[model samples]
Target: MSTQTPTVRGDAYLIVDDHALIREGIVRVFSDTRPQARLFEACNLQQAIQTLQGEHGPSIDTVLLDLNLPDSRGLETLQRIKAVAPDIVVGVVSGTDDDHLAMQCLQQGAAAFVPKHGELDQFVQGISAMACGGIYFPRELLWQVTGRLSAADAPPMVPGVASVRLTQRQGEVLRLLLKGLSNQVISNELGISPETVKLHVSALLRAHKVSSRVHLILACASPHAA
Candidate 1:
């Protein structure tokens, strides 16, 4: 039930975890990176929902949530956060490192899925991606999923294909994506609107025959991919 009121002008972050240590660690890292950023803390799903519904809710730009809260578990935690603050970026920071769970989080609208075992730098990267309206998965998870898909001997259209066609702008978008830029960042980089960037991203995914941005990046990383 404790919170740190953020300033009116900078980005606000909500850290939803029952563990005091985890919350403090995230707060410390985020403060190091974004000194002026606002932070809020919650112990469980109910507290989190309450904070999101409170006066500071609209100011929250991102939410770093732990999946295994005392009152909520698994994807339901993410779904509830999205239900209350659909526009706010939500990133999962779970102790579990399973790729299946990571994929599920992505499918369920998480902007990032980071395992608790990862280093702080990697965690920060995930947060950064989510903050900018982009999706991020751990590199190990990405490689694992890519390998699994590769082992399936996927159809030629699914990532390992030669020369998936792309418009000049799509190519620009792809290049930025490879660099791990989010839609908002890509839009700023390409001088296009975020909605336009989303369209190009969707086109890239379609061209690669993959469903998510993480998969699109994986496809682009393949040797046979363009």
Candidate 2:
């Protein structure tokens, strides 16, 4: 297994992929963006786990996981890591162009789903967003999911928020929220006043019983969500 040992220190991002080139490229991008950031490398799931269990383990907050590792594949690998360290922020790095699979990974608790072949900015954005407790739904996947959910004919709400049902307008507002749009932007898009948009958002938050917009987004974007 190939590995690069960095003595610089800051946030810890463990790149778990079987390919040395893939892991190295990601490390380069990270080093350029945050020079002081310490990056760890693992060629497979087992090595990845060992890296996490080592001395600097607790300091590690972000994990960049490749779905097609030698020891595992698909969302199962993500599930295993989360099972071991629920606190770790895992952002999936997939070569697959499957939106459904990417969405599934997000639902399975990945903080972000980055297409391996996508722009370098997107990969950085995914890791950066996840590091800050934000979900980085890839632009391609986001556009698709937003278009799909904009129809407002979604499935039933999941168990925890089963009682919360968003009206059509509320659903639109929710979709905008997931897109990270500001109230003014949403209002402009919906051709409604900002106050009206705020009203709907407040109602949605109350119905979902979330104290903040972030929680609301997480609840809705979850796999078991409405």
Candidate 3:
């Protein structure tokens, strides 16, 4: 990623990649996928900061950021962006093909993460998922990452939160929730009914003392939870 970026501006959807061609391609895809979205462009971390913190006041809904920016690298780029505007959603688009990087990005507050070499459909899916308050990791990458985790590696109980007493099914539901799975998606994954998934979600909300799935994600991601 280049350390120098042209002084550019954008709104609605922000595309932050060092290469102009990559940003142009993103704008082209979003033109069809989200026609209503106003596209913004930034070449590096510095320009991205200016665009995001400009007069619009977080007017941009989602940021598609390249991890290896001129001034930042990997998860550090995400941290800097969030620092500029904490509430703005961000999706990582990088050349790297590491599933663990995707997981780490998600846990660290990215709304989504996808490889730049992935098909255009994956990019579309990632943006769409984030727009709906869901997190996106390429399904294959997600499966591979989760598959590598054993029971011994599972998060331990939180001292004050009774998230520990969760039943096997409840635990299953929480794992999917942390993965940013929707209720219907969770049902499909677990071979359970949608209503059952809803019940489990409600139970998890109560157990975690968090009212929303997003909050549950934070609780799970935080050091205090483990």
Using TM-score, give the best candidate's number.
Answer: 1
Candidate 1 global Cα RMSD = 6.0
Clashing pairs in model 2, backbone N/Cα/C closer than 3 A = none
Ranking by lDDT: 1, 2, 3
lDDT tens readout by residue for model 3, 80-137: 9998888777888878767678668867777777677767777666666554446767
Compose the digit string of candidate 1's lDDT tens values, residues 105-154.
Answer: 87677767867775777777766565545667777666654453443233
Candidate 3: deviation at residue 96, Å?
1.7
Runs of candidate 1 exceeding 4 Å displacement: 1-10, 131-134, 144-164, 167-179, 183-226
Candidate 1 Cα deviation (angstroms), residue 220: 8.3
Task: Report clashes for each candidate as comma-separated counts.
Answer: 0, 0, 0
Pairs with backbone N, CA or C atoms under 3 Å apart (clashes), candidate 1? none
**Backbone clash pairs in model 3 (N, Cα, C under 3 Å; residues 3+ apart or in different chains), count:** 0
Better of 1 and 3 by lDDT: 1
| Predicted structure 3: lDDT | 0.71
lDDT of 2 by residue, 39-134 (tens): 778889988888777665676788889988899988889999998788777888888657688667766777667777767776666655544444
C-alpha lDDT score of every prediction, in listed order? 0.73, 0.71, 0.71
